[model samples]
Target: MSNYRHHSGYCGIEVRDMHPRIHNFTYVSSCVKYMIFMLNFIFWLFGGLLLGIGMYAFMDKWHSTGWVRLETFYDVILNISLVMVIAGVVVFVVSFAGCLGALRENTCLLKFYSMCLLLFFLLEMAIAIMGFVFPQNMNSFLEDKFTDKIIHSYRDDPDLQNLIDFAQQEFKCCGLSNAGYQDWSKNEYFNCSSPSVEKCGVPYSCCINATDISSGLVNIMCGYGVQEHSVAAAGKRIWTNGCIETVRLWAERHLYTIAGVALSIALIQLFVIYLAKTLEGQIELQKSRWAA
Candidate 1:
């Protein structure tokens, strides 16, 4: 019988030779762990890349248009990007820890790494909820704000009034003065021309009627010789264009990617834990056989 040593309080502990098959199993498990660690590392790298791109797009590269003012929206998007950057960094760090723990067979480090993965998973869920709940409404709110700004600016400017009059006289439209042109595009009473001069075959009037001017209303009237239909059409176009389908697509893709990374990390950690438990069990069994 092999010589026995006391391990802590336990006695008759023999260091038995591991079976060749058990050694092979350990080697295979090690290889699998390494592969999983590499895969997690790749995911971390990609997440960082995505986060950087989002930050640049939201904070550095985007510019607001005349009808798509983003002063408030910019701040919101900036905050979201900042959160994403932080999450990416956390994922990278935790995944690295998990790799190290697996290589070193450190159970403590593995538990901490699992916690990080859970943190990121929760964050992704929160982001997904926000995206689904507010993207469309947020877009519409921004559009309305932009339109209000344009109308308010025009209403406040005397020079704009003169310009509108000139446009109306040139195009023969009653301009902003008539109630018929108040919601001219939607109202059948006004003879508003097509948005395009080529299509309308007529010049548009760019004046506001006195009766149509309210104390607080914004003037949406275009320049003289510009059709009311054209101006209204242009406004609608700007509003629609600002909130494209691309924004929703971007949000959805990011949410999915983040969730996938978190899940992958979790699976890897579980696998490593299983391997450790198996190795421990095998070591115990070998000691039993040697004692027998």
Candidate 2:
């Protein structure tokens, strides 16, 4: 029998004999295919980790609270747990499709993966554009509603409370409103009218030395009744600026770093989409040869 060499273009395998049985030969580039799979796999693992953490947090809160009413759903989403769950689900679904699609060389799955990535990229672009076009509106949303919701719900959830505390300590700022530490008054536990000892007080996290281990012990009650003092007096003990202002300044300082990171993420996504599409085309071409 005479040997007939068959070569398919672009990462196609060489065949010694022109037999239809060679249909199983891989036409896609191994590098591209594996790269896609690995990328999705990493994200898949991350999604699963987020899902697990979210579930644990949610369940722990539920166990501690003993009951969850339908009326509390608004507060639920505002908390980090529910947010994590939603984010995890989205990431998991999209990465799952990508992982399986690349491994199986399934066109439909690859199409779905690429479409999802495109949608995400477009949504991010739109959000970035809107932020630039209407900076005041975006800032208003964050300064007014978003910050208030989180501040109001501060005492309602431990995770959220910790998060706000961490932000306060890290940014060296107190509260989310312009009133600075006085914003804690919005919290039911710290409200001036509240009977709790913590009334009119900000969390320990708002203290200047909250995280300072130099003394070998932290003064958790350092912020107690701090609001009763004037801002001038409190300024000596705690941060006087609101977290909103502090964070805004921080963002401005690191604007270039943030932009670079965002741009890199966008480009990486586009590159992955390109690889998926290229592999899909290569597979289609190989299938056509098989049919011929």
Candidate 3:
């Protein structure tokens, strides 16, 4: 009878010990892990595509130019090819780490992905704060240096030239410079002193009726020598207003939409970071259980 009682007590204690405590639980949530993995996988594919396209564009530009002379870091940052390449690389790396880490249950990759996202979020916040605090300085910089760079570099790069043309046509405004359509004088071919036939002329994109209605053909020479006339006279032929003012007005009109998009991006970043961190925690917990 005494041996039976002792064996029964030991069996009861062993049963109690087998009950799972919070830290002892080894269950890994597949839902959270797979959700993070799928979202990151989609982003990874997009990033890869962007990276490939950016690489091709950069290489082509380099071959055509023979050399790139960037006077400052700002110049390098402003370069379309370099900008696309940098953005692509960042997105590709971050998304790759996130997806692989989540799928493989890797703590190291998850940590890296989370860190990058956090850093990006902080940087964006800082830029936003600076914009709010230094609106005048930002506006001055855009008006002076940025516009000058775009206008002068327009003919140097086909992509840039097309982008400027599209902006002018869409905004129904001429140059981004303060002088408006007269800013064409800064271009070599359009300069008043230039011997080219396009001298003192704005691009056809600035013309009001550059396309024929019946034939549906564009009149490429519509803006020829338009800038040589007075503003009152030229106003009848081409858009006389500067793109800067037009863009400012457009922003004012679409302020809510812009804000909503920015907020959505921020929220998405936060959610991704959260998911990454949660998966990291779960993996760590599982590893701890294994160790115990």
Query: Cα miss at 156, model 3 (Å)?
Result: 1.0
Stretches of candidate 1 off by over 4 Å are 1-28, 44-88, 126-231, 241-292
Q: For model 2, give the RMSD to the true fold.
A: 5.9
Ranking by lDDT: 2, 3, 1
Q: Is candidate 2 or candidate 3 better by lDDT?
A: 2
Query: For each candidate, what is the lDDT?
Result: 0.46, 0.84, 0.82
* RMSD after CA superposition, every candidate: 14.9, 5.9, 4.1
What lDDT score goes with residue 154 in model 3? 74
Per-model TM-score, in order, reads 0.37, 0.86, 0.85
Q: Roughly what TM-score does model 3 have, to 2 decimal places?
A: 0.85
Give the distance in Å from residue 131's predicted Cα in candidate 1 to where it truly belongs.
5.3
Q: Which residue runs of candidate 3 sit more than 4 Å off their true CA positions?
A: 1-27, 62-75, 128-136
Give the 10-residue window scoring lowest on summed lDDT in candidate 3. 1-10
* Candidate 3 local lDDT, residue 79: 73
Q: Candidate 2: minimum summed lDDT over ten consecutive residues — where? A: 67-76
Evaluated at residue 206, the lDDT of candidate 3 is 97
